[model samples]
Target: MTSTATTVPAAPGAPAATAASAATGASVAPSARPAPVPLADLVDAGLEVPVLGGRTVRHVNLDLAASAPALTAVAAHVGAVLPYYASVHRGTGYASQASTALLEDARVAVAGRVGARLDDLVVFTRNTTDALNLLASAVPGETVVLDIEHHANLLPWQRRGRRVVVAGPTFGATLDALAAELARRPAALLSVTGASNLTGEVLPLAELADLAHAHGARLAVDAAQLLPHRPVDLAASGIDYLAFSGHKAYAPFGAGALVGRADWLDAAPPHLAGGGAVESVTVDAAEWKTGPERHEAGTPNLIGAVALARALAELERIGEDARRAHEDALAARLHDGLAAQPGVRVLRGFDDLEDRLGIATLELERGSVGLVAAALAAEHGISVRAGRFCAHPFFDRLATRANGLRVSLGAGSSADDVDRFLDALAGLIADGPAFAYDRTPAGWCPRTDDRPRPSFA
Candidate 1:
């Protein structure tokens, strides 16, 4: 299951590749590829917690779709830059110059990683929610979106005169409905998720792009889920805009990007109105800068950008072919194992496994999801997310239950983790949880079961 696309060419203005610049650009002299790290080698793999018999087992984290664990490479890059930290774009000091250069270089690195066009502007924001909000604010006319989108993609456009189209029964039919809706009215943008947060099924981006373009609408993809598993090239895919977060891509939390055309973004008023976003301020008004700086009104997150760039660079160094094969194999194993279970139903949008990433959503017939999830955490030391996964509309429309269990994988997930998760689920299905559970305001919690909470030590 290797991807056929080669690594994208470096963006102009990026540092020239050399022997020492192996992690920043694509032109490292051909050498042996770095060996991939297993899930057990991650920073959180050694975590231990008490289970049913009061015995501790290493925690098995199976929640990659929500927020993936930071990669060791990204952490190292953050640590390396600690000494040179400074206020970017303001100070003329030595560290400031270096940090500023790092921030700008990181923008170029991320843009290149996503195959952004030469004219596209990459604006770093807080997360996918913030990025989409910025785009929503900039959209000139009514926006069209699918009902299956994450809340981040769905909520922002509601106030902007949006038209929501409910998906049809089948995937292809859903696209046809969307195309018909786009035809019904003049639209400024058609926003969609690259992959469903619930089912992990990928959308037909190229086809959707063609449909949007044919209907005089620009396509914006919320790639928070897709970027982790596969390649998303803006130029090649004909995507007008792409929004994704750093945490989902093995970078630390707090940074995301909105990369796309400059026309809409430039024409709209600044997303934030103050400080660095301005060219000069008069008593009555202030002049705004064009491009990304126009919206980034505050001091930028230099460290976050550097860490994200390093993570993207590391992914490139590992090669998509190797990463995809590893994830696909584990996904197939997990899917097969789940299918073999008596009452387990693996929720999916498409018939083919290739249309999905390594994510599984399960609906159990015999046990309560809350009890199963709580028992897995307290009695089995396995972690998974059980909920609507932020797509309330999708769940309300398709799922028999409001919530389900989602097990997602990433670069760090290994055969051991997947096996452990399946074993836990099998045990749960064969026999109910050993402990009683109750749903509270927070979520499901153990009832009268007192186990020492694991410390980060």
Candidate 2:
């Protein structure tokens, strides 16, 4: 199913378009037509996951916090465009030109999805890790990242000897505390997540942004959790930069982006050294390209960009607000249901994990969150996640067991999945490995069993 919206338009001085440009290039595009239809119905109607043994027709996949499944529309769109793919901007050939146009157009498509500025340069990188790492190279101040950030956002700063500060446990208090800290420090940069990886907390974004600006600091949001399920108005949110991964945003390709503040990125040295990033390379010093090209070194992943753009379009058509409300209700169901059980502690210092959708990470007890995750998958067909996720410092602050179980959801998730998962968890902790998970194909599938599949790997 193709999307009806074509929302992006040409800038003030853009040239008129023809059939050829429309076929494969960026031009002043029109707005997307309203899509009364949503992909969720199609996903719900027929979806399948293969296994080595007797395959279950309807398996619960609740690992969306880590990575979400693709919309069928997105998959079909990518499949159709795969054959036309070419080495973008590598040559003067027709295919190369076509690919380059589509690649740039993907930027416009992404901008429409997020309501970003018309001229905002969107650089497509491999994933959230690469995108943020690339952006970090440009930041000119002592960086402030919360202990709540994923390792992807944190490690890059530490490796560079940049000053790092871990924020308070609660989101509201964290910002209040940071205001005073930033006052004492030089003009600094703050990096935070829109929705946290664990606990599914949506940070105090508007309030915190205000505080950051007050302290002469700007905030960069890791929207890896927020972008897919909800609307992220970067301009209104008062964030300086916005970062997110596509795999978490209904497109499971190696693609992600960091958008905003072109100057900081323009001033810093390029993250990767390569051909496309340079404007003109003599045998001596190179004349660097301007705009996003300055940062986006090497041959770009044109197909991944196309796929990500389409995925964002699909989400926009379905209406971000509606998706958030539906998924939020589902997350609440799981939270409340789990809280009723004995020995189960649902940890949330703020309101309902900050109005997040499709993610609910909690601790069953102190010692074996990993074990509980395994048991849930083995005995039943439920697929949830465990371990500290990637937010080591956040988990450390809350004093959770180093590894905790994280049960998440997606656009494809059902109430039945959560219900079955809750039932499975109740049984698993008591009985221990009901199906002998170490021995079965379905039981020991990619992410579950007697042990967890290595997360970092």
In candidate 1, where is summed lDDT lowest over 10 consecutive residues? Answer: 2-11
Off by over 4 Å in 2: 1-57, 349-354, 437-457
Query: Which candidate leads in TM-score?
Result: 1
Q: Write one digit per residue (lDDT tens) for candidate 2, span 1-457.
A: 2212111121122123332232232221221222122227324334443332334445677887888777788888888877778877676888778888889899888876775665566778888888889877877777777777888889878755455556654555666667767777855678877877877777768877887888788888888887877777777777777888888887887888878878787888887778888878878898887788887787787777888898888877888677866676676667766654434665553542356655767765533565556545544556687667887777766755565678887677666666667655654443334343331332232233243333575
Candidate 1 lDDT at 84 equals: 97
Clashing pairs in 1: none
> Whose lDDT is greatest here?
1
Clashes of 1: 0
lDDT of 1 by residue, 173-272 (tens): 8888988898888898999999998888889899899999999999999999999788889999999999999988888648999999999999888988
- In candidate 1, stretches whose alpha carbon ends up further than 4 angstroms from where it belongs are 1-41, 351-354, 448-450, 454-457
What's each prediction's clash count?
0, 9
